[model samples]
Target: MTVLVINSGSSSIKYQLVDPESGEAIAVGLVEQIGESTSRVKHTYDGEKHEYEQRLADHGEGLRFVLDLFDSVGPSLAEAGIVAVGHRVVQGGDNFNGPALITEDVRDLIEELAPLAPLHNPANLRGIDVARELLDVPHVVVFDTAFFQTLPEEAARYALNREVADRYGVRRYGAHGTSHQYVSHKASEWIGREDLKQIVLHLGNGASVSAVVNGEAVDTSMGLTPLEGLVMGTRTGDIDPAVIFHLSRVAGMSIDELDDLFNKKSGVKGLAGENDMRAVWDMADSGDENAREALDIYVHRLVKYIGSYAAVMGGLDVIAFTAGIGENDDRLRAEVLERLAPFGVKIDPEVNAVRGDNIRAITTADSSVTVLVIPTNEELAIARQTMDVVATLS
Candidate 1:
């Protein structure tokens, strides 16, 4: 069986056709610049890439063009036996704890929760709407917040005014829960232990960490939104609330301006003038103080989270790193583990330096904590969950 996993962003649609049982991405494609004058579609199959440019006025148009590519390019959806279409919904709020079959009511619920993920949900819903109209197969919505639904109250709730918090649904509904969930399960499987105390650091352009006990999430870094956690590529994570007030009063910034500043113009970019970690490292090598400081802040925040999550879980059995920076950047991993050396963490420098797509351990055999670099496959996770919902129909 195959599943087509679609992740729709504000102006792009990223998709993968996957065989969940084997975890192989049979084909992958992306449609960029939707609603723009000129849009680009790139599809890869059978080790070949097909690229094109056209005008895609909206999500419906973009998806229609994608379907056309599938028909013309090869690996027809019907020939591939696509069992279901999986949609990645960013925020399910407290309404869904697991993947839900896309009924009209579920679609409505996703639309209703858009305010919580203003930049994501609406775009996600657009894809869902267009896909359902374009394809007759069962469709499933997999939420990024579903895995974090298992978080304990203390970890999920905010310490705010009770009435105000409850009324506003103000709680820690984490982002990137899908990646966290995938990595944690992969870690457990790699170590051959289900009852593990795991701290999963998903460090990419967008980063978050989670503490999982056994297979359930106990605590996560992101709270209420994706903006609440680690020092991301362009996001100011863990900023003091008073800074907003100070900016408004002293800097004369409006709410919209402050929002733009915090989300788009901050973090590593604000500090180093470059958002990419590789660029920061390059500048640091050239002795750029700003770049060096950004790298230091990024590593420092990661170390602090590792220590805190270890405390939250009472003890740590495994520390798994996944995502762009986590799986690729050997130096960052070395720096993180070096700071954690006091806690009996020891890295096999030789093994850590090797790069590949497989899940492997970087820690020494006798290290107290088994540190691993596991490649996260959120698309496969979504496809599997989509299969689960499809299975229920029979």
Candidate 2:
């Protein structure tokens, strides 16, 4: 049987149909620029890709276009034998620790938790409302935050007044949990050790680091929201909370202004006026002081996290680097490993230079801690969890 995984974003619908038994995607497609007059749908199946440009007024219309493409391009849904549908719900807000069947109550709960993930939950619900209308099947919500539910109280809780924090629902709810789960498990399998203490560095445009012990999340970098972790492409990470108050009182900046400033105008973008790491590196190579400083700060922040996480877990066994930057940038990997000499983490220069879609060990054989590059498969993780959740019902 095939499971359809739907990752509904604010303006896009990314989908894949996979056979849980085989773990291979039968079809993949994306409907982008929803609500725009000129939108596009790119569908791939049977080793051939087909693209269509049309007016997708909204997600519903875009979804309709997607369905039409599936019919036109072949591997029809009926032929695929889709049994259930899975949705990537970004923030479960401490309510759901795993995938849930999309009952009315689940839908309502997803809607209610919108405040926690203002930019994601609503859009996810929008897709849910549309997907339920379009496909009459058992729908499941695979939360991105669910895998991190294993985070201990000390790591999950904030150092704030318990009363106020609980009242406002504020704490460290790390993001990229789905990716962390996928790669950590993959790394464990690759290293032939299930209980190895691992650090997953998912360094994408929106970066996050997770401390996973024995395939369970113990700690993570992101907190309460996606904007709180390691310095991201745009969002400023690990800033003094009082900076907001200081700016408001002394600099006369409004809270909303501060929000936009930190979330959009900051990070590498704020420092070097470029959010892309490649561009930052380029500028640094060209002797741009601002860009050079930005790179230093970014690497320094990551170094501190690596050291602290090793201490938190008592010790480290492996370092699994995944996602865009971590998997591709050999220089950055070398730089970070160079700082971890005391941790006995040494990378083979030749091994570190390799890059591909498969799992790889970049560290030398004698290195005390294994260092690996594993590609993340979050959508497949969602699909597997969705299948597991549905199997329990049977």
Candidate 3:
């Protein structure tokens, strides 16, 4: 059976029809700039690409265009044998532990939890609502927070008043559960060991790190929201919680103002006015001192987490890099592993420089820790989990 993976963002939708058992995407498409004056649809299949432009007034219209393309192009949904839709829900919070078949009750619960993931859950539910109404397929809600359910309480809690935390549902509920889970397992398979301690650095426009033992998530970087992890392209990661007070008390910043500042204006963008790592590197190379400082700050946070998580997990066996920067950026990889040389971590410079879509090791055979570049496939992970959830239901 085929599974449809839908990752709907605030203004975009990414979808794929996949045969999870064989790990192949029978069809894939993206709807970007939704609700904009002019939106673009990029669809791919059978080694060919097609693009369309139209006014996608909302998620419903955007998804309709996607279905239209499938029908007009090749390998229609019926031919793909689509059985279930795997919707990527970002914040499952305290309620979910795995993929859930969508129901009226689940939909209401997701809407209720929107405040916990203000930027993600609403968009996620929007896609689910549309697909349910349009497609005659069972839907599975694959949560990004589901994998981190295995995180021990000590690792998942914040040092706040227990009563207030309980009342407000405040805690370290890590994001990027799908990508982290995908790469960690692939990392183990590459090393030919399932029980090795691993650290997965998912460095994209949004970044997070995960410390995994065997196949389970023991600890992760993101907490409560995606905004709490490492210094990302636009969000401040770990900061003094008291800073919010200072900004309000002294700077006269409101909660709304602070939210926009940290979530949209801070991080590398706040420092150097550039968030793309590639552009930031160029600026730094051109003697932009602020960009240089931003780079220092970004790597400092990553290196610190690597050591802390390694200590937490006793020792690190495989240090896997996934996502955009993690997979392709050779410079950042070298910078991070170089600092860990004292821990007997070694990278084959030649291997580290090579790039591809496949899993490969950058560390030498003699290195104490195996450093790998594992490409992350979140859609596939969601499809498998979605299939698993729907299978149980059937």
The TM-score values for the models, in the order shown, are 0.99, 0.97, 0.98
Clashing pairs in 1: none
lDDT scores of the candidates, listed in order: 0.93, 0.89, 0.92
Query: Against the true structure, candidate 2 has what lDDT?
Result: 0.89
List residue ranges in candidate 3 displaced over 4 A.
none
lDDT of 1 by residue, 211-315 (tens): 999899999988888899899999999989999999999999999999899999999999999999999999999999999999999999999998998898899
- Alpha-carbon lDDT of model 3: 0.92
Local lDDT at 116 for model 1: 89
User: Compared with the true structure, what per-residue lDDT tens digits does model 2 show for residues 187-253?
Assistant: 8888788988999999988999999888899999999999987998989999999999999999999
Root-mean-square deviation of every model: 0.8, 1.3, 1.1
User: In terms of TM-score, which candidate is stronger, 1 or 3?
Assistant: 1
What is the Cα-based lDDT of residue 139 in candidate 3?
90
Error of 1 at 113 (Å): 1.0
Question: For model 1, what is the error of residue 97's alpha carbon versus the real structure, in angstroms, after optimal superposition?
Answer: 0.8
